[model samples]
Target: MYEQISHSLLNEILDELQPNAYERRRDLQHFYTRLGANFYAIHNLFERLYGQRDDFELQMQRLVETLVRKYMHRPRELKDLDIAREKDHNWFLSQKWVGMALYSAGFAGNLRNMAAKTPYFQELGINLVHIMPILKCPVGKSDGGYAVSNFREIDERIGTLEDLQTIADEFGKRDILLVLDVVVNHTSDEHEWAQKAIAGDKKYQDYYYIFDNREIPDMYEQSMPEIFPESSPGNFTWNETMQKWVMTVFHNYQWDLNYSNPAVFIEMIDVILFWINQGADIIRLDAVAFLWKKIGTTCQNEREAHLLLQLMKDCCQVVAPGALFIAEAIVAPVEIIKYFGEDAIIAKECEIAYNATFMALLWDAIATQNCKLLTQGLKSLPGKLERATWLNYVRCHDDIGLGYDDNDIRAAGYDPFAHRQFLIDFYTGSYPGSFASGVPFMRNDKTGDARISGSLASLAGLEKAAQSGNEQEIRIAIDKILLLHNLIMAFGGIPLLYYGDEIGTFNDYSYRDDHDKLGDSRWIHRPTIDWQRVELRKRQGTIEYTLFAALKKMIAIRKETTAFADFNNRHLIDTNNEHLFAFMRFDHNRSSKSVLVVSNFSAEPQTLDLQTLAHEGFGTSGQLIDLYSGQQPVIEEGRLPIQPFHFYWLSEY
Candidate 1:
């Protein structure tokens, strides 16, 4: 990428990197070195994005200056961390990093109060905490803080900026990683820029896609699919004040930013660096797939979007190298992998992305009571870049979209559309003999596409079992919950536990009474934290105690087991029993140490032939112990017996 003209321009800019007498250029050399290494790529990306603009050189200079200013603002401790991380780039891909995703308001009422629950996280072996978006927004139609009104200000109702800093300081002391959200895709209409645009500010109006009429929006909508057909039906909404149509890919209140505008990109980069300077170890880039738009296309997972992310990563490298970006793009599995960038040994875009495919496949197994689809789905999922990892979770703050590939569905010997409909019916309790008690979200009447909305426990049948007062069903539900937990923990990634899932929190129907929340069924799963109910984790024999204790034990074991590290060394073994799914995890360092994970999805006992598993080097005569129960599995002759809804993390002593 030796562009003579660009290189000369960059050299000239560096020559002009003069500082005032009062300014100390401490670590300015490190910043300059990084800038030199990354500027070529950054310049190329910027030229491609805004080369036609008249102020292209000015914008490039502004981008470079923004990085230097942010680097100066970064704390000394963070700078030291950056140097340490530079030495060990793969530090985050370790087995010890178990994560928990929680809303700051629900977890402990506020930022300062959340510090009191640090011991709770420590006791559960959670070292990474993803605090859901807490930025300032309109109270009622905030879209759960994704519609960020202000990038720098914390939502006062949740806590002040000082409170967040205090909690981050506390977390740092305990070796815990604090993750926050940066809603990079869009902003609330109440945002200052949006307000200015509403007031006929032509400069701010260019920040978003605003049209005088629906002609262009109509063309864009011809290809852009509806995100929330039940609520916001179109991609563009007409603003009465401005008398113009503004592009809003999610909700009308959230205006999509035009990344084509270099100024907007520069502003977002500053916003991201601002959070990193405020002690955020990881910033989740929310809705990254929809960042770039093009007419006659889906406007998702586009090439330009990736270039934007690469530029952001390069800029962050010049500033806070210790901070990492999580690509919050829940797109197709193939597209999701690209978010990690196509680098051979390093991630240039993002270091982590959500394993949405795995989450959907796990739910498919729950619905079908078989592992055929789950196995097929995983086989098709592309392996991510070596330096990047997945944030694997059973459920999050969002509803579960069945985004499975049709090809995988057909490979599992089922009709793609029919199977999806069956899943919806079963989970919503409309199908006969359905055990799940869940609700449907964003049901598109035209396309017949719907997503399931419910807490993990509710979707696993705990709510239905409790309602029926069935002891056997309750036990089965608890086993199912543990079985899913076992897989995610032993899965080749950082397993993120939703806040209340460990305690078997069920769906809260009370959201229906709130006018602001009733429209979004996702609120059903986001119940307020009940401390009184959380105390049940201490009472033996209670469902809460059982789930909490088992998860705690598994989390501890996962931290200790080197075999569970995310090294992309997992190999699936065909048990020939449709109800049983098995995978082998070998230590990346020690070839002799391995763990064979087998889970039965059916409600009946299943058997696996040791002879068949011998192909995977697991048929040896060594004693097979279940790590969860710490007892030898029942083996008759050569077959291992797995109880109904039971999973065994089998390892040899």
Candidate 2:
């Protein structure tokens, strides 16, 4: 019955569409077929959220029209790519796909220059490059390009859209995947829609959550927590021009969209498709957790927000089935897994999501010199849908938030509050015997909460070691860096490397001198690439050369290891040594092909009893070889000793 209703509505929408679109639809019979298959689910989802509104049918027509237009705009090459991806739907799950996230301008001066430097990424065995947000945004007011003034236009400081197309073209030839950001939650006040809203245009005002007064805003503030307490103090900001209180969850200038309005949903869907047409293989939906707002709720990770994502994903499938979505939801482990969609097998919302739990747990292990909480946290993390995978990384273009579960912390034999405070102090160099040189960010005075910010090298103790000219300390830091990278590479997902971490770049304190960046400590890690420093990778014995060479080798080995593919084949091993984090990975098709990954997180050596893993075919193995170093671990008294900050990928042929 619902299918008939959806088809009837689609027919009406098709008839009302322009003649050009109709002609193009005939050329795209596949598009028509896909629309026919998915429109029912789309319609049901849309109606579920907006059926009570008077403009329900009209909004439905507009939504279908948006999908049709974008489908027509998609180039023939992209359509062909879509068809190819459809045939191999699980292509992204391959072990060969290693990713790196970076800013175009910061990495190579501009889009064109970045394209010219494609060999740099290829050299590091990176085939998935996530260029950070480059859309047009207000100068000085842009939250690092997340506050988009214009969705379609590229930021002038970066190159033009044509340059981005060039990147897509060039990267395509290299078989590289291009990932782009779509800031779906909010837009800059300088945007045309916001401008009209401020000018008292009723239609534009409906695009955002602009309230007449503070009555409803006050109700929302009661439940909603402040995101950036030190910088952006409140959830509501007063706009004097319209005498309205607007929802500014992140910052005052960035107005949150009213998802209750179907028009807003249609507009964002159009923006997403436009970028997909421009050559984004993967679209990272920014701040997906904050899409829906409700009174007496945290306004994050709501059910309606998941429905919105599902709708957006369905629309994209009809237009470009190959394009994958990455949910950038950095909430708790339980909440974050939902972004992968609540399906028994296949993911209905996003194909990929950030493994923030794993990332933060890695940091916790580094700080505490143990895997107690890391192991406990992994146990508590909900298993994702089979079709989805994790985007694992140590750091990105954001501050590190200790959003660990208190239960897991307690299970690890530590007080949650005191443990978190210790991590904060250790990273900021305030704790005794700390080697990290990170800075505190967005410290909430009321809640005694704060996040740490710094480059990976700085946080791993390279900065202090280099500053003090301690060669021994520098080697330890380098080992620590490699140890972190090794886990992510072998950790059942696509390991995302940040731009400068491969070459051991330190935090740039110069961000503090910039007027626009002074308030944000995250910018300290977003440093401009020193090509001169990058050149050091060619020189042996240099820190850059050592780190880059080791990482490149690991990436190559990871690509060759069939067991490294993400098929939910990872099993955590009980080592009984708190300093050792151990897990086993097996090829999903051939369980006999397996690797045992074990790492020592402490400064002191640790031993793993081979007897514990004897039942899993380890102690009686016929010559266990380390795939990483191609060496054999000497087992004495049924125990394997591991050096400080070292790891091994043990396998038996």
Candidate 3:
């Protein structure tokens, strides 16, 4: 991108880059200074792809100009943060983080109201908040903001962009991280680019992968999997106005961008930095696995996808050094780990990723009441790089798909295909003895693979038990929820709670009446917070109070323990009690002195052999205090007995 531009303009960009980005000859060189190297590699690739265009270098110059302009516009406070955190780059992989993902409208009705609900985060000890896409999109057709028409503009229904800035500032002052989604994979058919594309402009059409007929699309369909089986049905959509078929992998409205074009990558990089400079401490890269697609493949987790992520990481480091990235890929465990990048050893990609495999495995344990697969699955998970971590959660806004390996299912003594069907049936209450009330989502007719959708409490039997007036069943459900929460908190990473789960919000069947939402079963679990139930918190003898109090107590205790830190160091204890799941969170510096967390999964008392635990460095030289109960556990003759569905964080003298 060599240019004979005036030195005065170059001086302006150099001046801006110098402030936050360290200027060094060799040592302590920032990634920003190395931009020219990235530019060389990218320019060579793009030139090879679009070499005939005379405007290729012109576009390259404009892209660099945009980066310089955005860097200059970045706030002084954020710039200062970049300079300060330049050395200790992996600050995001910390133990203090606890995230909650929510929709701006569903969680609080709007961004302004959501600002007022910061106390909700405080009560739950959450420091990381991921507000699912508040960007503008088409009505009734937006795939929950995945089909974003504009990234900078807030949807008319969700207040203004100023409200989002205010939320970010307030959260920043409180040391809470504000995470926003950057849906770089696609945009709505109504977006300005899409409109230009609809006008039969070849240049605008190049921004997306558009074909005049189904010849190429049908070739892609040969290897690509349909995301939404019942609703969207396919990966390509026909636009009658343009008389072309566009790639819409998730929904018809979301026209997948063509990242093979360098101009598209540069534009998305600007959009990403736009949010980061707007005060976002973290950015969740949504559907990043499908960012780069090629022919003759499923077009997911491709080599080009990894290259794109690397470019993004490099660009972000130049602008917002303090900001972090969480990869949102939910594919199989093997592919999911690649989101961290093979270059993770050098901290080249995302700092955190979703522990979706653990989420799926936990569901497996719930169904089978055994830990064989869960144990084996945990063993199969490769230890993450030093500077990366996992965002552990039980249930999120999306449906839960069984993403485990088929071999793991078979080794657990269940047929892979039949087990998944059983899970969907059990959760949807189609099974005769099922206590759950979930709905089936994305049921693939060819493979019979389907995901289950419901809130944690609803699917854990609380909804049915609460409606049937069965106190014992309800208690058991609450216990199971807490037990699961215990696993997330103790398993050496940040534990994220879905907003409604804290109050046991049930499945809201109200979506069934809405024509737009009726087609998607995931809407069942997208329940708004029941203010009345939330008000019942701290009240005795109520379901809300019981769940809230237990969770609040656990959160308080988790924050106070340094051993709870995540460093990819947790040892599973085969306590020999099938109903009990035991694990030790050992401090890397002090392995001999560690807290032992034991959870009883059954509905009766279970005993742990203290002598067996002592082999893992647990001892009874003095009184053992239970952190959650705030009481000294009674241990006699080297054994600790736990009540049904109870968990203990045992600390010895």
- Maximum-lDDT candidate: 2
Give the clash count for model 3: 0
Please, what is the whole-model Cα lDDT of each candidate in the order they appear? 0.91, 0.94, 0.81
> lDDT per residue, candidate 1, 144-235, as tens digits?
88999999999999998898889889899999999999999999999999999999999999999999999999999999988999999989
TM-score of each: 0.98, 0.98, 0.92
lDDT of 2 at 528: 96
Summarize candidate 2's per-residue lDDT along 1-653 as a digit string, tens digits.
24777899889888888867468355679888899989999999999999999999999998988888898889988999999989998899899999999998889999989889899989999999999999999999999999999999999999899999999999999999999999999999999999999999999999999899889999999999999999999899999999999999999999999999999999999999999999999999999999999999999999999999999999999999999999999999989999998788888999999998899999999999999999999999999888899999999999999999999999999999999999999999999999999999999888889999999999999999999999999999999999999999999989999999999999999988999999999999998999999999999999999999999999999999999998898999999889999999999989556999999999998898988998897647577889999888887787888999999999986
How would you encode candidate 3's per-residue C-alpha lDDT over 515-593 as one tens digit per residue? 8888888888887786767989869999888888888878888877777887666788988877778888776656435
Residue pairs with backbone atoms closer than 3 Å in model 2 (clashes): none
Provide the lowest-lDDT 10-residue window in model 3: 22-31
Q: What order do candidates take by TM-score, descending?
A: 2, 1, 3
- Ten residues in a row with the worst lDDT in model 1? 14-23
> Which parts of model 3 have CA positions greater than 4 angstroms off?
1-60, 344-346, 620-623
- Best prediction by TM-score: 2
